[model samples]
Target: MKATELRHLLEAALPEAAHAEQSDLQLGHMYLPAGHIKAVALSRPVVVGDRGSGKSFWLKSLVDDTRRQLIGKTFQQEELLSCEVKTGFSPDVDGDYPTPKDLARLVQDGLSPDAIWYAVMVHLIVPESLPGNLVFWKDRISWIQEQSETVTAKLRAKNAELHAKKQCILIAFDGLDRLSPSWRDTVALVRGLLQTQLEFGRYSQLRTKAFIRPDMLASPEVRQFPDASKLLSLAVKLEWEAIDLYGLLWQYLANSSIPSQSAAFRKFADKVAKLSWDEGSNGVFVLTQAVRHDENRQEQLFHQIAGENLGRGKKSGNTWTWLPKHLSDAHGYTSPRSFLVALRFAAVDSNKRKFAGKEFALHTSSLKSGVSEASKVRRHELEENFPWIGDVLKPLKGLGLPARKQDVVIKWKKAETLSSLLAHHEPVPLPEAIKETDPASILAALEQLGLCRLLSDGRIDFPDIVRVDAGMTRKGGIPVR
Candidate 1:
């Protein structure tokens, strides 16, 4: 292919590489992560994952008919289609779940959390079945509190009817971290929902799924209930293995609308014996099979995009492992969102540089530059999710990582980082779980957020994903190359 054609192909083939936070249900293709295959198929009640690990994506997919059908087939389970899925809570404005303020008010009213959830079910499943002329959610809540037994009886009857038809009602909840004003209240609500799920287990036809962030699960308040271990035991942790990431990349590439671009990608796949087609689709191909590890094929696939080495030649570390390793957090977790963002930016860089003679779409310099772009995005995401972390870290921009705790404390004192953070965000009650008023508490919070690691040697280390974007250098004051 000519330089211009390849550039166009690079642009067209990798458009919008990152998955949207709110995934579109209409997108027919999904790369089911191997670790999550069984979890999704079994309908686990509590699913936990860090941000960008596809909790929302899976929840949205389960509610989408076409995507649900495809996913069901992937697991070879027809029962997936028998599910009547409803979103109890989501970040999407149009989602059915009540707002955080409404939930907070309900909790404050001393209404039983279990009863509140039952009321939500009544609203979704069969509003007419509810007693006492309770049409709205607020009214329904009052009625449930006033007549708990009656509401339970009605839900039981409806569950029985669905059981007879061999169907199940699956209610999903996400965005729990935003569902309440304080950590205590959020935990109380989540505990109630989990207890309700346990109680409903007897119904056989009703199931509840909650997508919770890892931090929320780790909160002591959320796990204070008597039988919290049962829910915790059943929780499915959403994870992405390296191979899973590659599978996703090919899945997107195979679905490309540009004929020549798709053709070129397929040709590249064939070279590594990694290309296969779906049964019915004429031109659609499966790049890498969804499995635990296709090391050879995955390595080849990465090389196709990022080339054989980090730069120059094989002497420069292997590109296959370098991309994800550099993008990973302190916990060694690299989200699909981050990976895709890097890929997209790399392609854009490759095209802009016009490296036509290179064997791969991404040059080493372009790939490294892509990592830098991804780092910025990841930092912004952390800030949005936990605004306090940004406030704490912004003052330490020029400080080097893998430094002693005392060094950080010195910087903290010099910059008045903690004092300013408390001052600017004062009077807005901090989440009871996160203590940001002092230096020790701020460092602890940063460690929990995976923005930095507390080394056993009494030093601190920031992951490349965070350090590069935060403008922090490594030990010895060496800047990121």
Candidate 2:
């Protein structure tokens, strides 16, 4: 296919957003990362990921009946096929569980988060024989603790029943970040939920998956409890590599809405990367471990679309390497969401600018523009989760990257950045659960959110992923007016 034809195909091939859409999920188009099979195992209790990672997306997928089975089949986990998945926590409030409002109220009332979560799951498992007047969270938690033997007996019987039929009940928890506004409360809640998961470990068929952010998992407050190490042992990080991102791209391309678009890319994939993605019975393309892990093969596949390098001269960076590097955060992790958004925008730019004269479908300049757009989308995502980011980052817009750490700190002090974060985001949780209000503390929070990089030599640098959209400048970076 010519550059123009391929760009058109790309426009139809890629999804507009990085997050999992119900349409995409129902249509069986999710690119299950092979490397993440272990991280997403039903037995794993704690799932951790950084910002813009697909934690929320997976939370939704696992709770959705159809997609959950699809994940099981893709990962070849037999138990997941017949397993019953329950939503123990999420943004959407269910009648079975307490809302964030209820949890906040209950926490303030001195009810343990462990009791609340365990009660929530117990009610989900066996709703009968519970208090009819347990309309309040405190009352429900009190009931669970008071009737501990009754609840465990009921759970044990249910587990035995399910085990007989080759089924398991996996309670999936997510959105602990929104459990409470206070950092102390969030950690306590997270720790309690994790402790509850530990308590459920005795039963073979009773499992819990608590999807949490890495920072929450790392907090000393959360890991302070006894046997917390067991929960930590069950934890896994949903990290994506350059090749995995490419594999995800191919999954979308192979399952494009337009049949010919799908065929065109899959044909090229087979020809170039020696990749043959089989269409599983579940109506999605499946990738093998060999293709998923083969960096060289994946590079060849990507090079066909965007070419080998950004420039013709030997000194320029390779497009395959440069794309992810530009899209990666300071922690060296590339979110799949940002990855897809960059390519989709690049294709749009390629078509609009008539920049298809190059040998590849996407031109170098257009890819850079793609990174800019992706950065903007990523920042919007961060703002949704942490509203204070825009205010803190706004004053530093036009600041040069890789400057001395003291220099950035001085600017933050003059702008009163820490005070702004406090004064703003009234009910919203502090950015990345920051406890320290000092300028240095605020800067560290920014780094935790993957907004900036602290150099070994006391210099502070911004990764191109965020720097571009944050309006920060770096030497030889993409030009922005």
Candidate 3:
């Protein structure tokens, strides 16, 4: 087949949902990594990840019956198929839980954070028992407090009944960062939720899972409590390995969708992974276990299309490894969404080449172009969460990479980068790292964000993706000239 045809197919195969929104409910795009089984199974109370790591995606999937059952097939977890999932919190505003305003007001009303979260858990687990007449959150929390014994008894009874029926319930929490713009409120709210999850852990049939970010996990204020160490010890990070990233790529291709023609890409994908497809109920297609965990098989299969020599200028490379090597963050983690975005952009960029009868589906130049394009996406994502990042780094544009750390700091100082971010989330609380605005602190923050690399020689290195996106120059990680 021609590269053009395959490129077109690839462009259609990858999903564009880079930002994991709760509304993304496509069953076909569900590619659960083996490591995430515990997180999705609700066995782990906390799921930690950075942006684009599928935290919110899995958060929404827990409440989705179709998606949950599909997750059930991947692992032998019983609660997955015969379980009740409730949204304890999410980005979308709904009456199921307290809104940010409600949380703020509840705190101002002198209600303890633990009490507020416990009331929310009670509402999720036993909604019928919560007063139907209570319209406002404060009133409902007051009622729950007044009837604490009754509520506890009801929850215990519900758990016993679920045990009798061999079913269970999971109260899922996501978007905690959105609960309050104030960092203080966020810490209190998260600490309360953690306390609530620990209390619920006593019930085998009732479980609670909170999907959070890495920074929150590292925050001492949030995790301060009795036995906080023991409860949070079981937290899992939704990290993507190179093999897992490629596995997800193939999964998207194998289960690629076009309205009314669901299985159209199956044969094309068969030529790639050569794995059996399990046609589950409602025709949701997923690959057999052989495809997800087998790193050797994935690489061998990928090379069948990516060709033998992806490098040039008297050097050799494997596209299977090269793609991720060029795209990963400074910490060596690549987002599934970023990987797909790079491939999709590379496919589209390769269409300009018209490499008639070219053996490879992607060209080296196009692959580089794809990385550059995906970095733009990454830049936007970084800006979206940390708006200060763009302003801080703007002065370094056109500056060469592997530069001295002091040089970069001088530019940031000259630009007054710290002052610009001081007012970003002002009336509302700023996100993490805003308090530490010194040049040295800012450099550390950038390293934590995976935007810059710290060198042992006291130099700073920018990943090719970030460097290219920032219009900075780098000399390595490409074919040797």
How close is every model to the real structure, measured as TM-score? 0.88, 0.90, 0.90
Error of 1 at 203 (Å): 2.4
lDDT of 1 at 79: 76
lDDT of 3 by residue, 1-481 (tens): 4555666667777755354232344677777777877787566888898878887788677777877777786677766889888888888524388888889988888899999999888877888998789888788888998998999899999999999999998888888878876667888999999998898888989998898988777777888988998778989888888888887776677566653233544565566656557777776677777665777767766666565556553266777788898888888888877788888877877767654444567766778777887788888877766656787778888777789888887887888877776756443334455455466577777787787788898899988767777877765543211
Q: What is the C-alpha lDDT of each candidate?
A: 0.72, 0.79, 0.76
Error of model 2, residue 319, in angstroms: 0.8
* Model 1 deviation from the true structure expressed as Cα RMSD, one decimal place: 3.3
Tell me the deviation in Å of residue 219 in model 2.
2.9
Best by lDDT: 2
Residue-level error in angstroms, candidate 3, position 166: 1.9
Question: lDDT per residue, candidate 1, 409-429, as tens digits?
Answer: 778778787776766653233
Record all residue pairs in model 2 with backbone atoms less than 3 Å apart, i.e. clashing.
none
- Give the higher-TM-score candidate: 1 or 2: 2
What is the Cα-based TM-score of model 3?
Answer: 0.90
Q: How well is each residue in 99-150 modelled by candidate 2, as lDDT tens digits?
A: 8788889999999888888888888877785878877778878888888898
By lDDT, rank the candidates, best first: 2, 3, 1
- Assess candidate 1 and give its lDDT: 0.72
